[model samples]
Target: MAKEVSCPNCGKPVEWSEQSQWRPFCSERCRLIDLGEWLNESHRIADPTDAPSEDPPPSDDLSTPH
Candidate 1:
């Protein structure tokens, strides 16, 4: 039996097999919808670190002495 999965975009049943062109998505439209979401910045991966990164301190080597 072919394994089934839900489409990430529309929650439709999708078969997980060689015949399934889009394993996670039901159709081309759903795939494009997901792509649009990514392009629009609707989906984002969470940062690994909790704290924000701090900028590096200004370098004094570039400064010319008076």
Candidate 2:
């Protein structure tokens, strides 16, 4: 028996096989929906660093004669 995985978009059972074109997604509609979400910033990777520092470090060029 082949292993199955739930579709990320619709939670449908999908066979993890070569015949499964979308693999993790059930169909093209589900795949496109997921793509749209990513494009719209609905999904984002968490950043480990803190928010950007307001004050930037002093540049070496500023100290040199220009």
lDDT of 1 by residue, 20-60 (tens): 89778999899998988887663345543545788786666
Segments of candidate 1 deviating more than 4 angstroms: 42-66
lDDT of 2 by residue, 1-66 (tens): 989999999899999898999988988899999989887663344443444657766677667666
Q: Which ten residues in a row have the lowest lDDT in candidate 1?
A: 42-51
Q: What lDDT score goes with residue 52 in model 2?
A: 65
Please, what is the whole-model Cα lDDT of each candidate in the order they appear? Answer: 0.82, 0.82
Task: Compute each candidate's TM-score over C-alphas.
Answer: 0.59, 0.60
Which portions of model 2 miss their true places by more than 4 Å?
42-66
Model 1 CA RMSD to the hidden true structure, in angstroms:
6.5
Residue pairs with backbone overlap in model 1: none
